[model samples]
Target: MSILVTGATGTVGSLVVQRLAQQGAEVKALVRTPAKAALPAGVTAVPGDLTDVASLRRALTSVRTLFLLNAVVPDELTQALVMLNLARDAGVQGIVYLSVIHADLYSNVPHFTGKHSVERMIERFELPATVLRPAYFMQNDLQARGAIEGHGVYPMPLGSAGVAMIDVRDIADIAASELLRRHWAADPLPRLTLDLAGPDALTAASVAALWSEALQREVRPAGDDLESFEQQWAHFAPGWMAYDMRLMMAAIQQHGMKPAEGSVQRLETLLGRPLRRYRDMVRESGQLKLG
Candidate 1:
């Protein structure tokens, strides 16, 4: 049974495809532009758009499982619901969803709201589903690479809040395992909500310190004020995205995005191994540079 992966070119989805291909699973990747998809060898590339039901239906033929991640769009909920309906019609056996942390509690954030809506739809479907809610990704640090190098600073809206940040690769690894596992049939694949994180939690300051140590350069954590950060982002980002980012940052500050106790156990049980920690990612990526 082949596995179909949506968002096949994205950060987490791309890694999921790679891991599945490495495991010898028949992997089919759905991409809007097949030419741009750099999927690994032994994987099928199907040209499709998630918003188009016909394309999705065509991609779902003979696919047993699906890895679902919505594209960044205003109509994400509508597109996801349409895709879920088509998957059900095509007899897809299981679904693994990559969603944001605390999506249910943050309706003010449009992206989280979209994800929550999709999760609710998945719960109501006959198709077994597992939802993986991963905390803030380390990849977000890459967005500030230039600034870090130029000004010795990392500007994030996350204030004094400590978050259990995870690497996208770790998230992908867990997802690929779930998609390839055959043990779900006996238990019917519980509608699980997995909270994924690195081995430890770190505040913005602590993250900068790690980067500094890794790169042997002094790095400063900037943007202690939310309004200033929001205004700066709004100058370049779309209104909706800027607003959502601000709200998400605020939620992180107020509630702290750290994983709950036993989160690491859940991750370990799912992968049958310990999760990768932040330091491992720093060493592997070699993106951290010190002043």
Candidate 2:
């Protein structure tokens, strides 16, 4: 049976599709535009939108497993429900959902709330499903490239809060493996949710230090107050998104965002090796410039 990957053009979803295809699985990628989907050679591209049930149904025609990842948008819960209903109707056996860490704790963040809603829906459906609650993406560091290059600084409101940031590629690997594994591979197909994280926790300052060492240059950490940060980002992000970002940052600052012990072990067990570290991601992305 083929595996259908939603949001196939996104950071994690794209890697999931590519890895599944590389592993010789019959991969079907659901993309909003087939013209722009540069999927791997053997994967099939189907034009579909997660918000449109008809499009999702068309994409799930013969697929057995699905990697469901959606972008944050207005009415995300409604759209997710539409997609879930269609998947159920289409007889898809397994679903692997990408969720955020501490989704249960930070219900105020719209994106995390949307993911929690989807998790509940998946449970209600009682279909074979695996939910991966991963920490913040280390790839987010790439967005600071301009700042790193121009001013040698990394700025965020995370403060001294340390988080076990996971690389998107590691999450993709786990998702692909879960989707491809036989139903009876383990009794009852394991638990519903898995918390995937990197090997170590690091604060914003520690991250800046790692980049400084990697680049052989001073990398400062800076951020305005949360209110100011929200106001500044509101100019570029939607109002709701800006608010959610601020709330999420505040939660991270107060709660420290670190994963529980053995979270990384779980990821390592799934991948049969240690997960990639943030420093590795920086080097791989060529963002680490050595003096």
Candidate 3:
């Protein structure tokens, strides 16, 4: 089975490509630049831009399964729709969409709304798809490693409230399974929607404690004001991204990031093992920084 992975050079998409290739699958990485794809051996890097439907036609050629991960761009919805149309036309059998957790609940966020819009299109088109709503990535904390190591503080906007953040590794494994697993019966399995998270529901304070233990330093918990956070983030990122993230963080602050009961266990079942906790992520952060 020939599988094509979009956003192949990204955090989650790259891992999916590696997992599929390691499983002995015929993998095609649909990236904008094949020379810079940096994919594993045996994985074919096919140059293609999702924004250009014509380019997608060449990449989707003979691709039976597709792993779709739309970047957080202003034209995300348009790009996703174009890819969906091309995939449908190319006779791609299955699609595994990498979507944000709580996208349905927090549809007001622009990026989440964009993903939801594409999801609606996928359902409306009656495509064979599996939607993976993965929680906030543990890798996001790496951005604040400097603060943890130097300033000795955790500075996320999330307050004392707990969120069920997950590891990208788990997301990649589950996505690969959904994309490559074959059905036993003649009838194809129904389209599935999974809410994925880590083993523990962690708060900002708890995260600080983990960092302190891992780094053997006093990493204090520092609550962030949303307004300041947005202002600071906007300076570095796009205005819309800062605004969208601000709104999402506000929602999380108001309504805690706690997952539904049994959600963790269900995710573990799909992962085929226990999910990684914040401490585990902290322990691995040092290695991640070097990479």
Q: Which one is best on lDDT?
A: 3
TM-scores for all candidates: the values are 0.92, 0.93, 0.93
CA lDDT for candidate 3 = 0.82
Residue-by-residue lDDT tens digits, candidate 3, 1-291: 589999899999999999998888999999887887798999999988988777899988888888999998889989889898988899877888887777777868888888888888878987888888887889998998888898998878787667889888988989988887731123445677788888777888888888777777688877869998899789899998999889988877776566667888887887778988777777776742211
Model 1: per-residue Cα lDDT over 95-131, one tens digit each? 8888888888887888998899888888776458888
- State the lDDT at 228 in candidate 3: 84
User: Model 1: which residue pairs collide?
Assistant: 215-290, 217-290, 217-291, 218-291
Q: Mind giving the per-residue lDDT tens digits that candidate 2 earns over 1-291?
A: 688988888899989888888889898998878888898998999988877767877888988887888788888778777887888898777788887889888988888888898888878867678988999888887987887757988877667867888888888899888888732244335437888788878787888888888878898887636897689679888888888889988888877676767777777887899899888877777756533
Shift in Å, residue 145, candidate 3: 0.4
- Supply every candidate's count of residue pairs whose N, Cα or C atoms clash at under 3 angstroms: 4, 0, 0
Residue 262 of model 2: what lDDT?
75
Candidate 3 wrong stretches, greater than 4 Å: 182-188, 287-291
